[model samples]
Target chain A: MSADRLIEAYLNELATAAEALPAERLTELIADMTTHIAEARADGATSEDDVRAVLQRLGDPRDIVEAATDGLVQVDVPPRFRLRDFGAVALLLIGPFALVIGWLAGVWLLWTSDRWTRGEKLLATLGWPIGYGVAVVCDWTSIPLGLTLAIAAAITVAPLIPLLKNGQPGRSATRTRLAGATPATSSNR
Target chain B: MVAEKVFTQLRRGTLEYCVLALLQGEERYGFDLVKELGEIDGMVTTEGTIYPLLARLRREGLVETSWRESESGPPRRYYRSTASGGQALADFTADWERFRTSVDAILRRGNEGRRK
Candidate 1:
């Protein structure tokens, strides 16, 4: 029932439910669970046991994780709305690639350049969707209204690709970066 | 109780093999797999944990899924391992046996040393 015990139970539940999740992601979920327990207990609960009790009442750990991660990553593109889904796919296509290109350019400029190159520093930041934008514009003019939305959807999804691509494990660079974002869970070691 | 010990035993190896083996027979709903693994003597994972692994496996083309209508409620995503998964599982199983015996021999040697 105590806060510590609540966290412990929540972590155990999350770890079990999220067994498929990577070590870093599991750690992140645990950290988030800690935050949830803290917030739930913040209403003047004196001890950790009260927090644990609150977690018990909140239902299964699977339920919590199921909800938290449910729609967060999903685009929820309706199948019936073929146009919209296409737009979403188009959006996804160009967004993150543009973001990564821009980010890499920024990093290189910051490290290599002796002085300000207006284009490298400024124009590169605009790279987040130059690819998707061009596609969207083409769709807008040529495609029907329904199809236009498909292009838009793709653009919208672009930003997530870089973050997701970065999170991929088995990549040496990814593992090194994951070391930073990872929380204090048993999986890290 | 089973889940915790299974997790500790996972170490860095054996996980992939177990997963492939589990899905080798038939497609299973995600939560069902998690629950099944939990009941098993050597797994300590939750649905939350399994989902991410499922995603990665799908990305890697090791498994595939389809949304099937359920009798009781909403459609459920069912996962089944691919042919590649079978080969991978076989390779992993063989490698694990080799490693396990090697480690067991080393430990036994240490115990023998202590007796001496």
Candidate 2:
């Protein structure tokens, strides 16, 4: 292939390898490589061999991408339909016969996950128990057992509605923090 | 291979400072810095890696960049050492000198002991 075609192919590979980079950063990286290639050509790298030598000095695209991404910590958002989430939901929804075990497992899932804040987790964990407690109290107060139980179940499940619908809780916090920091940084510029 | 790995580790820790040192005298564009660092043995294995490093340095406020029209061809982004970069380089240079002298002394003593 011609030297220009070879450089284009190398850049295409670099773009694919650096797909995870932020768009602006990826553009800058590509622009830098293009400038570097151009400068090399100006410095007498006319032949395909000379172009290859220049690219070889740049090393592998994968290695370059890895180096760029090194030390960056990304927040992991869990998928909507994880088995753990389903299991926790199932345990919470089950009748009070297995309520103790189900509540413990649900609480465990809530605490272990990075998806929810501690406050959200506490609300969800207390939801069913509080509902169940209210149901028992109503039952002792001469209220119809069936109606009280239904009301209790509804109350217990209320806090979990947001958790279920959102699938992830702390995303808002992350987004807001990032949004808040952006303006401050831009204002300094 | 082991020696090369060790050298790579050492270069990784020191390459940013070297870039800052290069920019101390004159502002250089990306390609210019890449070419200079690339020529140094064990300094930079990959020319592309320097671009990312430069981006990081820019983000960290160690280097400032400005776009200027080149004498020939398209505009180039020239990088110069910022005040913070200069101070960091000065501190690193002092630490490097002390560390190098200590290491050199130990190696010399080891050589003398072997000769005796």
Candidate 3:
């Protein structure tokens, strides 16, 4: 069989086998199988009859899924779920503190800009320090679990600081699919 | 952006039950479940994806598997829903209906608001 024909048979067997298989995953599996079959054919499995027989020996498609997902646990959290939940909880819990800090930060920058405008470069440049002081004082006062909350906020915001370091969002899903197919020891050993 | 997450969670919550439901009456192996899901208009998913889920259900003791030799090929694993799995599926169906109805209501409400 041609590589394409071999892949078609392979996928047909697969589709007929699993009633809940996702199409994306099936397409991925078919692409992999097709590539492998092409390579095998190139390696001198000359006849369609021979190739068909070889494919048959590779076990049923349904068995492949059963082996792959058996006992596997995956957490498919959407990108903005916990982040949104995080927003909601933070709003109820520490939203007031955040707003104050942001406002004070902007005010502090303004004062620093004023000092620069007045040519008081030596000592008046401490506007940032002043802002930090104000924010810390606010943190110490009303935010109940203020320090712990601030620490968590810093950590959470720190990830966003390096968002660009991660792969771009558009193709990330496809990349995830590919990475997940790190062939399990259950098969092709 | 918020909507994307809601849709994803909705799909995730129901997909597990859908898989179990398909296998309720008969003991089918992996690919059969994938094909069945794909045949549905908006329910298409891949077999490769379903395998991991099957493994999950088996591990959770919601489903069980055994080998059944196929005449066309080698022996295949056959999966059947367990009693607990069946019960869970029933609960899931209830939950799904509630979620669907509520979501539909919300969508309709939003549409009416837009029209107004």
Best by DockQ: 2
**DockQ of every predicted complex:** 0.03, 0.23, 0.05
TM-score for candidate 1, please give it. 0.40
Best by TM-score: 2
lDDT of 3 at A15: 60
Judged by DockQ cut-offs, is candidate 1 incorrect, acceptable, medium or high? incorrect
lDDT of 3 at B67: 80
lDDT of 1 by residue, B15-114 (tens): 5457778999789876566556656764543334455556556655778988887664445678899987777777777777898899899999999999
Point to the candidate with the largest lDDT: 2
The lDDT for every candidate, in the order shown, is: 0.54, 0.79, 0.54
**Ranked candidates, highest TM-score first:** 2, 3, 1
For candidate 3, the clash count comes to: 28
When only chain A is evaluated, what TM-score does every model earn?
0.30, 0.49, 0.33
Summarize candidate 2's per-residue lDDT along B1-116 as a digit string, tens digits: 56988888888788988999999969999888898887787688887899888887887788999999877667889999999889888888888899999999999999999999
* Candidate 2 chain B worst ten-residue window by lDDT: B68-77
lDDT of 2 at B77: 91
Give the chain B TM-score for each candidate.
Answer: 0.85, 0.92, 0.85
Q: What is the C-alpha RMSD of each candidate to the true structure, in Å?
A: 19.2, 9.8, 18.6
B1-116: candidate 3 lDDT, tens digit per residue: 45765765666556767888888878885545655676676453333445556666776678898887665443556889999889888776776689789989999999999999
Tens-place lDDT per residue, model 3, A50-120, is 67754664457766655444333344423332233223323323333567565344334433332123332
